[model samples]
Target chain A: MSTLRTEEMTLNMGPQHPSTHGVLRFIVRADGEVMREAIPDVGYLHRSIEKIAEKVGYHGFMPYTDRVDYVCAMFTNQGWGMASEKLANIQVPKRGEYCRAIATEFNRLASHLLSVGTMGMDIGAMTPFTHAIREREMINDLIEELCGARLTFNYMRIGGVAWDLPPGWREKALAYLDHFEPILDEYNALISYNKIYIERLANVGIISADEAVNYNLVGPNLRGSGIKWDIRKDLPYSVYSEFDFDVPVGKGEWGKLGDAMDRYMVRIRELKESVKILRQALKQIPAGPVLAKVPRNFKPPAGECQIRVESARGDMGWYAVSDGTGYPWRVHVRTGSFAAMGIIQKLSQGLMIADLVTLIASLDVIAPEIDR
Target chain B: MEAARIYQRIKDRFGEHVLEISDHQPDPFIVIDPASIEEVGSFMRSDPELALDCLSNESGVDYKDRIEVVYHLFSYSKRHGAVLKVKLPRENPTVATLENIWKSANWMEREIFDLLGVIFEGHSDLRRILMPEDWPGFPLRKDFVEPTEYHGISTVRESPIIRLDPKKK
Candidate 1:
């Protein structure tokens, strides 16, 4: 006279599913809809970029950085370039610095756009996602026009930018900015304040300031948890400090600011700030040589130097250990998304199946950054 | 908040175990004995003045004669940072784990184990992260030799032969 009962079911999210982003698999043990344990399985997209870097010369390795964080290509470009500059002790020209700032800020906007748009799609709003990519198309066009590639724009050279700003580029960029800000307002009205979106995101994935700092979370994920830390502002590599912009933090004003909502809000706010910075950069850019005077084949003196830059996701660090050779002895990338992904296991625990998509999307965990 | 004062405090506490402290061009970094890493790391994180609560990056380097474990620690409150290095002989490069101090060290230690073949003495799950579980050698080490084939499949280094049609040829 015993009744039969079902044990907890095991579910596999993806090694190729759309919601999992790129080649990421999660094994979840759940009782009903509530997740018991979510174990992330990576390495599906491992390219051995570090090993490849050891084989190529310093300049030749720039393209590999492009493949690592495919979404935020400029950040990767800057990370690798800045690391080489630090190790080589090369000085960039003023015009080169201005262009770097403009390109990096544009990349940040594009990355944040994808994150916000994809997160919206993950949470069941398709229209906002479409609108986001429509804006991102303009960014891709600009990047392609500048670097001859859309996604992997290896436009940053060690001494400076690969090329000068094209004619009428400033006017085109300013016009895009004018058009883009209104779309952001529409995005906020459509997704950020939507009752359904807020309900799914608010207080869903909560990481306190203590835990955030302890885990070394960077970018918007760290800002979302109410910590005011941005390498661009704090370290001020390049001319980021010269320009006036805001580092938006998650105040939990809309739907527990430190949760998924805060993460979304921070990106939206940053999009506006990036626009502001781009406008300033376009207006003030001077006409001069973009490339600094360096040897045709450059080699840094034997030493190790670490360069940390704020990527769209978090603090992207490149530690270059040189041996006075064209190739680096060792180059390690401390990606922001890799650090943010650690919190996923903790955040996803005890949340429902539907909430998992929202949580992962909220963190904006890019897979190549995790696997690389 | 000068870098020297922070190095001085660490030197005062650790004594001769602090091998070398210098303010290099990029930042202030210290090299210490591999055996003393855990104790020194705990002190640096807990000290109110240093308060380097955040473990920014933890990585391993494979020099010719020895292996080095580098930890980048930062203090959010103080807006200061320091690099802690522990060098161990190549023959037996095992260092005490810092997972007790900062939880973020968990995966980073595993990665070092996978790449450089350096073992963290007390890591809960020290296994291959980037490479396959059954993969032979530590990929990042200088001594590593890439295999031409694994289980009959050609490796990435092998060039595929393109068969041209007789007419085209």
Candidate 2:
């Protein structure tokens, strides 16, 4: 008997596919139905914001940071603010810190909602996505109230914030939080624990805890692997230490630890944690001026420092080098998605072609964050 | 596990491979010889007491005559972190790849190579990450000139606002 000859076939996922998150292309080599390898081809959305940082002055570059991760612009805003503050040796007042924390926590929730909803959609469920967007709409309104814009919220400054909370915005945000808490359960009931959803996600794209550490996985993806490491808790910055909240790690809930389901579950758990932090920030927020009296010609000392913030995605770090001039010498945004994109190709091998979508959703590798 | 003590341990262990320590900054960094960076990196990851498991961030900065590749390492088990700097001449700044030591360094080193033109020896896939393959001069270099065109398309943005400006000289 003679065996049939077979060859590995190449497939391009997309720089335009809706499911691949943003503009990202994956050149996947497949052996029949199983993926032999998937080489990621990025740089489609490379804005070269780092180069722009050198050209633009410190204060002027805050808007550019917004585009770094539009889904979680607040985190990048905070990251840039914290980095510049450290570079300039400026301290934000307690109230200012609280305000920043409150805004950031809310942004985290908004981002996670999108991720959770979209992950549901990616795996074939659609109702949960709309449910998530409904709740997220309220959060966006509150965020827009805090910052002038909703998506690219350039709300943070070198020392503090761009604006104080609008009148009764705290009351409105608190009400939204109260209304939003039970929506999680409703959404879970709707699709999270659906048999099909579990079957689709569970035991697929399993990354060991050690592999997660090796790959420098961050955010829910790392926590889903049962690592129990969060920059907010482990390396606390801002007033994160002041507030008490649990860092939820994957405990092999539905399948093996660090499976696609575990990653999804971690995001669900984080939504509650983010709310807890927001509550503390809002209640303890003291009344004071929001923006610090930064100099017009914003020149930081000639030094470099690494500032990391627990963004919705992961440890969003900004490494800035200043040259005692208005312009930054060098700025590098170390995004969580960048590493995720690199590691995806290795993880995609030997898996079914369809599981690739599940893996991308679970990892939450948004294209702007990776490309920027 | 303070920065000073970590610096001392690495210096003692590696001897001359540990070139110098810059302790002035809040996050002190120890400069490592380019030749021994790969060895030092592997040791840093395996050493139980100093298990720098995660490569937090790897960035490159071009400083006219020299290009500095900075590696910020964080140990999850130890809960301590350290920074290592490997400086090289502006021309052909090639350092051994950390991709073997930390899987996270794969894309990061590619990024540094793309922007700053620092060649990482033994990098499994050392290619442009955020820039096109045949793109001219490294954009991050202080002396890099912006391309006039990319694939026959004008890279210049002839701004309508600038053209409409009455204050134009």
The estimated TM-scores of all candidates read 0.96, 0.98
lDDT of 2 by residue, A163-271 (tens): 8888898888888889999988888888878999999999989999899989989888889999888999999998888999999999888999999999999999899
In terms of docking quality, model 1 is: medium
User: What tens digits encode model 1's per-residue C-alpha lDDT throughout A1-372?
Assistant: 368787999999998889988888889989998999787777788788988899998989999999999999898998998899888889999899899989888888888899999998887889999988998999989877777888989899988999998888888888889999898898889878888888878888888888888877888999999988888888888888878888899998765657989988989999998998899888888889898887868788988988888889889888889889888999899888778777778878898988888888888888998878
- Stretches off by above 4 angstroms in model 2 are A1-3, B162-169
Model 1 interface DockQ: 0.69
TM-score of chain A of each: 0.98, 0.98
Which pairs clash (backbone N, Cα, C closer than 3 Å) in model 1?
A219-A314, A252-A257
- Model 2 docking category: medium
Cα DockQ of the candidate 2 complex: 0.79
Q: Distance from true position, residue A340, model 1, in Å?
A: 1.1
Candidate 1 residue runs with Cα over 4 Å from true position: B156-169
TM-score of 2: 0.98
